[model samples]
Target: MLVGPRPLTFVAVALAAAIVVNSEAASAQPDAGTSQAAKDAARELATKGIELYHKGRFAEALEQIQQAEERYAAPTHRVYIARCLVGLGRLVEAKAMYERLGSEPRPREMAPAVRDAYGAAATELTALEARIPKVAIAIVGASTGAELSIDGNPRPLPAGPIDVDPGSHVVVVTNGERRAERRFSAVEGAKVEVRLELAEAVQEEEQGSLVPAIVLFSVGGAATVVGAVTGGLSLAKVSELEERCVDGHCPASDQDEADFAEALGTTSTVTFAVAGAAVVTGIVLAVVRPGGSSANTGAAATSAKSIVIDPVVAPGFIGVRGRF
Candidate 1:
């Protein structure tokens, strides 16, 4: 027997339809260019979302309700969104939503249904205040470039208390190359404080360049070769003087050559001592002066602790000395 539409079927069909006549529909007037068809579609989606929420399917309900608000742009939908966020264990976002709703004016011209939704958001926020977690962060010795971040995303430092979800969170403070990080758990409705400490700044001297060492080594090597050649000539001259003057006594004729040879020997000895000291100083510098090469650019540049190495060259002294 063919029967008229069954009671359950009629109820389902009614639930599927949009409620255009409700007072909630009057809350925010349609935008300037909104078409009648668009309004009807948005209303239908909101209706479906409400039904899903009653059935305890909060995630699906949140998506539908969010779309409806985006389509219609109503403040009343905030209440529904916040409710769904609470159901999803996202207490922080839900608290922000409720706080935003509370700060907005309850439009005196609002329809009764919209006013009721606003009132409901206010009442809900009161209870949520006790269940939400509060977090405060303070930076000690923070530099001018210091910045705060939460979960890897940059955020402004809170002047007062900030709402956060219960559980573990990463808080970071960064100032140039210096960074401070903290990871900890927060309990619901409890206050957590974090102090970020900065490390002390160090003063370092500028590094010595390798060019000076290389130059010194080259010059010293040349000087040493010149000194050796002069020394050999001076020795040969002395041998001739020794043959001419017998028993360490130089005759008048050999006296002039003897004085010249003595003078040459002194010059050679002084030059050799200076050259040896220079070469030793250059070698020590090349060994310890770090990566001052022009080839090392960008990150390849090395910073090394430096000490002043001096070439000590005197009439009788030739060595390398260092003062840290």
Candidate 2:
């Protein structure tokens, strides 16, 4: 006889449930052999690292622990690795590892060790950072061929990484008719990068106004012309006195002529002095005027370009020396 359909359906449902249960059981079984093998390898590496540490081979110990740490995923293994790094004076790497492991909640029994390791690593890191040298400076602006200055003294441009005493300093930058200034600090050997934008206008002003030179020349030239005229009038008076003295006259008239001659002589001496002063003034004006002479023009241009005034230091504190 043929089996009934209801019986067939029930048998199918029982088979499906059995298959599902078997699959769950298989998945739940731990691969004890694989896990044990991994643990054994990690332990072996850690033991080798410890032996190296005992032998005073700190570098090798660090290498072995690092390898085991990479291979093992356990928090306990990682702590050991951090400790080895600390022993090797690799404080930065040790600090990183300890910080990572310390963030996780450890078992109550292991919490104290973890906290201690973390604290020690942090302390070591702090000490290392303090011992290292560091420098911090703001480069406000620079021209293509600009030079740097420290505390108003000319320093080489594009300064090589500088090691400086730990403190703040005044820094200045200079280019043709452009300048910039800022404060900076350095500590031992650390490099501090600071970027400051220099206002183009302010730099131009720091180079100083060109108007002063022009004013000086103008005033000097005017004074020179006035002196020349006064000198000529005095010279003419002396010549007239001599002519009168040469003409025949009575003793009284002659005496008056003699007096006039003395006065004229005095006037001539004054004229000569005035004339010398005028000539000197004119020469100075000519030399100082823009584009007047090759030497003077070059000097004036250089002065204008590299000028910087330190108003805070003193009234006469002028930092004029610079490299081209």
Scored by CA lDDT, what does every candidate get? 0.71, 0.49
lDDT top scorer:
1
Clash list (residue pairs), candidate 2: 133-188, 133-189, 133-190, 134-187, 134-189, 134-190, 135-190
lDDT of 2 by residue, 92-202 (tens): 466577567646544433233233444454554455445434444456566588777766777675444543435576777766666677777665446766555556543
Model 1 lDDT, full chain set: 0.71
State each candidate's clash count: 0, 7
Clashing pairs in 1: none
**Candidate 1 versus the native: TM-score?**
0.57
Query: How do the predictions measure up, each by TM-score?
Result: 0.57, 0.30
